[model samples]
Target: MMPLATVAALSAALLALMAQASVIGDDGRQTADREALPLASIGSLLDLDSGALCTASIVADDLLLTPAHCALRAATDADCAWPRTRSDCREPGALSLRDLRFVPADDHQIAPADKFAHSRRIDRVVAHGAASADYRQQRHNDWALLQLAEPLAVQRHPPLRVAVPDYATIGGTALAMPGYSADRYYRDGNPVADVACTLGFVAAPVSLIEHDCDSTAGASGSPILIRDGDGGWSLIGLHSDGPDPRYARSRNGEHRNYGTPSSAFWPALMQLQRQRSLQPPQATDSRR
Candidate 1:
């Protein structure tokens, strides 16, 4: 058997690889190398796909942090938030209620045996008080918090820790994400149908860097994660949007993408924490 230190080092390297992402499958599924990753890598795959295709990070045992735009479900005629037609209350490009679900990392793409098969619904979405205003003024600052109806069992998987201004250090670190796309299965050449994970870089604060990390419409909110010491993970950013073909071709057909950095706004996150704390305990069901 390998020495304990050697084994530990090997494990760390494998975990780091998973932190980098793969391409999305055509069916909006992922082809993750499960055997190479730790349970924690699996924990990061919480499916918080509310209406707008976005990604999220598990900040706490039961809480997830994501973009407000992703969870801001557009009110429809069937479920009107205002009397003046559900369409009136909606923004230009908003997601409807039918396109959202929260599946744990392990059960997200490839369903586990029996205990983890189907994706679960998000119990409630807690958008920051100023999310709408901030999103309008600065699209990159749009962020929110989510309360999973059932607490995930990530005690075994090293959970991610929230960071503030340290995002600048992300430049050279490795990153990854497994996300869904328009097509539900994996495909080659087609950006829309591939669900994959690839190695990426945490650029300054604006764009999370990557050479092969091409993303499409369905990957708007994919979590960009980086591994720290002791297998700990930190969310560097999320896949926001990709560069235009003109921009890419102009720059020698290079692949470049951007994400809303977590460091960009702290008030939004704090607001989420406060809201989560104030929620009535009885209103939720524990999934311990």
Candidate 2:
């Protein structure tokens, strides 16, 4: 679970972001060029059993990063016992180590409509927690590293580099969060991105961040990015939810999006590098 302190700080940031929402409105939202760097590095996850859709990003040639909760697969078999709400079930399982496929899609098409293109099978899902009776309990550990059945070709699918939070420059670089948000997802497959968003101020040991970025169900597990000095983008976190159980509301009774801090997941990603699952991005792919 997310620490209370982190939740409080994010909530505070939410209050500040709301104050600027009027001015930030439609200006912060933009359509991403799908063939570009960051958007090019992202794709969609299809839960075969449930036919659910979620966003995922390539962190390495053979690995994808996303929210673990996105793996929740509800059982409706006769062996299943149901004594609670629709969300709760006995022996609730997950899509981990299952047949979840990652499918790359063109910006103009709905994700499920183009499942055959560049689709890769997921062989494993390494996560801090799994989908269970309660999802909120695993919100802090919402991230998962998915190992693809085969590596993506370097020239065609370069991975996005992870960027950790710099304590010394917390108020620095402008942020952007591009994802396939559910609300406008059907209108056009083009993903909606909240570019040049603000983070206000964050507190240390920050496990989560709150922002005014526009998002919905499909946007979960989308990458929160920071513009680098070289006119490129690096990942700062994975967008999780808006005013979830941890930080339900701000002082002004407003809700903002929450993201799992990338800095907290850096070591785990590096471990994958040590395992040789992560490959170097080509210079041209860097958009330098």
Candidate 3:
């Protein structure tokens, strides 16, 4: 008995609601409300070469944690020039540090008028010794550290503390994964997040932790966080890769994400923090 015009309008509204619900069931929400504080520590890593972007977390005033592959030329090619030693990777022009920018709390604003006071150029990059040119090695040594040209003012954007949750404690625990995903496609480049993911399991040999968090290409170094009882969040790992295509479809039909456990790189992080603390303050750049 409804008029034709009214019926059409109601159908459109119903379709819109269904579309929104589908997105929610697929990738989770944008996570702005539940993770505002922790979001401040997350950012985007822009590779000038291929125009590729990845996620990263600020763990210290001058240090960032991300995946090793983000800094490599051909990360998955085993035949590519791999940094076999510390000296090889640290030498001047050994690895590409030029044109690499870290934008903390990046909301993906590309407008000329947008304020980007928190973005900084990378001064140095260090990957774990185990990281190699082979794709197979990725799961084992996917971690990397990025040192900024100058320390970010911690008062404005606080750094996250890395922690390795006990294996028993992590099983069935809820986690939040925040990142700047390529598919999110915001005109302003705002980061998206999955706030209700869970740690499915851990692969001890490769030090890989698997989770049900929804992620995409640009989320390579996104942080996996666990909330504490005292209302604080701790960094547990850095997202590295998604499940194999064959095995992926079976796990909730969403990508099964993986990350390198924070405990694997705790010693290196501590050493870097100590060295950073010992360094004298340098002049601040006004152009940044």
How much lDDT does each candidate structure score? 0.47, 0.63, 0.66
lDDT score of residue 216 within candidate 3: 64
Model 1 lDDT on a 0 to 1 scale:
0.47
Candidate 1 residue-wise lDDT, 1-288, digit = tens: 444335334433543343223332222234444443332432322222222234556666666666555655555555544433455445654444333455445544452222124555566655532333432223355556666767776664345665565544533345555454433322221112122334444443333334244454455556665666767555655565555443331123444455566665456666767877898877555775
What are the per-residue Cα lDDT tens digits for candidate 2 across 117-227?
446888766554444344333555577888888988756667887885563236434678887654444445677777767654344434456566766556778888876
| Candidate 2 wrong stretches, greater than 4 Å | 1-28, 34-37, 72-98, 105-114, 129-137, 165-173, 200-206, 244-247, 251-254, 277-288
Candidates 2 and 3, the one with greater lDDT: 3
**Model 1 misplaced regions, further than 4 Å:** 1-30, 35-54, 81-99, 108-117, 128-139, 156-158, 170-172, 181-212, 229-231, 246-253, 274-288
State the TM-score for model 3.
Answer: 0.73
Count clashes in each candidate, considering only residues at least 3 apart in sequence or on different chains. Answer: 31, 0, 3
Model 1 TM? 0.57
Q: Any idea what lDDT model 3 has?
A: 0.66
Q: Is candidate 2 or candidate 3 better by TM-score?
A: 3
Q: List the residue pairs that clash in candidate 2.
A: none
Which candidate model has the greater TM-score, 1 or 3? 3
Candidate 1 shows a clash count of 31
- Across 32-86, the per-residue lDDT of candidate 3 in tens digits comes to 5534557778788866444566788988888888887776553222323455334
